[model samples]
Target: MSNKDIITLLHGAGGSYMHSLIKNVFMKLNDNYGEVGLEMLDDAAVINDTVISTDSFIVRPIFFKGGDIGRLSVSGTVNDIAMMGGNPIALSLAIVMEEGFPLSDLEKIVDSIKKTAEEADVHIVTGDTKVMEKGSLDKIIINTSGIGNRPPQLDYNINTLRKNRQPSRWLVPTNLRPGDKIIVSGTIGDHEISILSSREGIGFEANVKSDVAPLNKLMLKLLEVGGIADAKDPTRGGLADLLNDWSEKSGLGIYIKEEDIPVREEVRAAVEFLGMDILELSNEGKVVLAVSPEYEKDVLEELHSDPLGKYATTIGEVRKDISGVIMETVIGGQRYVGRPIGSPVPRIC
Candidate 1:
């Protein structure tokens, strides 16, 4: 193989190896920044204030039903910034590809990265790439990091949240009153189904697809409309896990109406077929919003303006005394729901 095309182990050795790796592989992807970065290589980047996060994806199948590793890599990082209440600004990507991987597939991945970024409006600023011997690794693995400044409007803090605070003052859901309403944006479990359908080689009975999407746009609008006491992306553990954690942290009870919970029939059927609890399935593009009842309409209105939140609705409420999560059965009973204890489907974020 031509030296320019072939990867050498020296690229990873950290001295000349790392330098050549950065020069030959990483530089081609990110372009030269400046001398400021020549002095240090940080795993983290400055976004705004103190908000920062990092994530890695080693999904077994690499490519899935609704999205591929490229989009996942970008969206996952963007979601992390969103989860931290920050606006996504820039990202860096790294790849470890096995030898003999097709250039066509690599081009597809690059195109996917560009498309996802264009939709999200975030820039891919820097990255690294390496190739291992054919037998040493999977076809590819991706690592990415991002940074962004949080808008002053979000003004998020865990402790400032409580019943007595101003609507915009922020209250930790731990203080959730028995009367707190649980709001969810759009549907759930579709992302898991998408991956399953791709992995298991099954087709949807209807037309269910992944909920994978970037929530930054809709969330910016929601923040403007007010009523968001707390917000989070229902990622790995699904809404059930998120609610249970909120219940435990705030020393309050969470109650939900079974009939009110949103689920597409195809997704529901897939969950039933796979013997998976719809509550524990992963979601990529969905968010969990806990808001006060009075402001719920304004919040919903903001959500409805965007395609992502067309189905936004109140699913449940917070309670004062129970300190656990419960769902009122459509059959006229209430059952406690707990956080998912195990990794039901890993690498979902």
Candidate 2:
């Protein structure tokens, strides 16, 4: 809704276009309730200690290797609230379906939503459904809004994940500082590669599956151990966009070791074949954290204890020497990790 009269897929890719669109259009009629609004641009909005977030899912194929649009819808909203250090309590589901869509498929998708919500310890308290004429839309699209509450005793202490400096808010990327260690919850590019292989017919015999999962429990465990400065789940823009946003916001550079960042062999193979950078692809379940070195070991231990984070690794550390994301290559060289401006793959959550 900028100067252009039409909207493109890039406007929803969670990159520059999406950022600008949100700022220029939807944000113009802003009513953020004074304390919590759209300005922070964190994962969720917090008002009076309650956290809330909403997201729409239009992933192609509707069903994929490890999840469908249904699961993605729930996890997307729930994770947004959790990233803000809140325990998700409930969600509202709305669906738009094209006429002639299979009823069996709808049942399966709804079942997936129920299962994921149960696993994430939340409920779908309300919902709505609408059907469109044939060919008017895709098979189905889902929108979810979630609400949560910060712990009663949330504070800056070692037991709490909330930052002491920003008592009014919880964890945010801008809270990062130099010398803080960077950690990724698990392997990158698995979800994107899985979708590509299954949907694009670029099947890799290695069997890569989507990492579409909820990260609330994993994050809760880490928050319990404390020392975390900031956290973000790398979803739409992958690790590159997430890191670049952190850099631009904190006015600091993030140095990640290429050898230390985790990536599955199959994912790497697919990325190489497609001539794409794994860093630019999207991930659904993984989280990136900026933690203080003092508690890095403890935080890693906590993450490793969770099944979702068994492959967690300390990938890098925040730096003040520069002003952007720099990755130390395996060959002992450094390169700038820039933001992805266009959508590499469309309709990817």
lDDT per residue as tens, model 2, 238-282: 999999989987888999999998999888888888888888889
Q: What TM-score does each of the candidates earn?
A: 0.79, 0.94
lDDT, candidates in the order shown: 0.70, 0.85
Instruction: Determine which window of 10 residues in candidate 2 has minimal summed lDDT.
Output: 152-161
Q: Which number leads on lDDT?
A: 2
For candidate 1, the 10 contiguous residues with the lowest summed lDDT are: 35-44
